[model samples]
Target: MSRRIKGLVEFEDDNGAVVRYLRHPHGGGLVSPAAHAHEGAWLAETSYVEAGAVVHDGARVGPGSWVDVDVVVGARAVVGSNVHLGAGTRVGSGARVGTGARVGERVSIEPRATVTADQVVPDGATVGGSGTGRRSGYGRAA
Candidate 1:
């Protein structure tokens, strides 16, 4: 696939090294100048992403998917294709958020946690597990 950079900017990395931030033409969200997205991923124009975030190939972020700082979305993870992700929510790497899943505001999905395909996660809920039992609140500290 041919990918072209639609948005480009310079930012300082964690090591203080200057780096280039690139966004694909498919991304319309408020992606930070420090964030990077693949060509096939779709980030809505209203969504926001902080620095150190990445949306991989074929993943779709709905109009309001709030990708927090350092969040990493796995390849082909369908996020809010039909539903919207609440503001300020964070999705960890290797976590697959199914289509039409309503992830409430401020929800945090731990790394490797699977929200299942088309599952609904309520607001302020913490989800984590091995993607086998559909566990919730397993890695959250209350």
Candidate 2:
């Protein structure tokens, strides 16, 4: 059975394990207790930070953003509204994702990288990692 205590949910997992998740006060999003959301980090009510996720200090996750399990949102990173960060995605510090951006799984958004709004980042693509900022064949939505 699931229980709520002071905005924290104790969910009974299918594996017979009960886990704890804290609901964001501002956005009502679910953040796993195992996840690390810095005190300075901001999460919209409509966002979800799954288990093993790390939202560093100063990072901002907009509304409707889903930070899947094991995702790493670096310090000062900005995840725009309605953004979907696939599992294992690493958003380097200072990176900025525009609204409606869909980042594929295992995608690495290097530090200081800027993803335009409504952009679709394919799975396993590397953005702004050393060599070239953005990989070819990726751009804003039509």
Candidate 3:
């Protein structure tokens, strides 16, 4: 599917960097420059990936979403609008995270699996099944 934000989101220009808006409105302003994502990643309006969160190459975080501490959005992964990725979650390469998905802490996203909107993957849980159950699409070796 084509990549684009799909909800009520806000974009703020803080200095030269683009900052996404966290719903809680931290740092003493609705639009603060310090809320900016690291390395000049393209942050959608009202979609906030907090500091220390790494969104790598071509990863798109949709509008109205919040990616919390130390989360890693892998290359080409698509995070949908209004979705919340808890701390230490890993969205694998090419995985599609649907809108309103609530992923729990330390979850693993298998590559190429489609996470339907509003699906909740509990902490340390695995969603997709490997053809042989030996390895999920992109999850751990367990």
Candidate 4:
């Protein structure tokens, strides 16, 4: 019988890393108390931000999105609905991930990069950069 803490949700990755999150005051999303979500950041209902995740100011986290441990969503970045940002991933400022994208761990989405909808980003992938069109993250970063 595991005694779960009130208002706390915990998830364990395949690597045995356990992440936890608390309820967000504004949108009923799950945001870890240890995580940093700016007051200006908009967290959609049903989103989950794990411990150690940082969502900077002006960022909009879409519904059903998951920000894993140690992930940083830069200022003004827009994470699409149902997007999954794995551990150690970094989304640069002004970057945008399209809806339903599943990004693996340790991924880096550069500033102003635009990931297409429903795209699958592999682990350790580097995406977005200057001159990147809407198809950024569809392939390796130039």
lDDT of 2 at 75: 95
**Per TM-score, what order, best first?**
4, 2, 3, 1
Better of 1 and 2 by TM-score: 2
List, residue by residue over 1-142, the lDDT tens digit for candidate 3. 1122432234445555544434322212122233344342445666676666777666777888878878888777788889999988877777778899898888887765667888877787765633322233324325
lDDT of 1 by residue, 2-62 (tens): 2335565455667877654444467666667777777778887656667777778767677
CA-lDDT, candidates in order: 0.64, 0.84, 0.64, 0.84
Least accurate 10 contiguous residues by lDDT in model 1: 132-141
Clashes (backbone N, CA, C under 3 Å), per candidate, total 0, 2, 2, 0
Model 2 quality (TM-score):
0.79
Model 1 global lDDT (CA atoms, 0 to 1): 0.64
TM-score of 3: 0.64
Ten-residue stretch with the least lDDT total in model 3: 24-33
Whole-model lDDT, candidate 2? 0.84
Error of 1 at 132 (Å): 8.6
- Please report the TM-score between candidate 4 and the true structure: 0.80
TM-score for each model: 0.51, 0.79, 0.64, 0.80
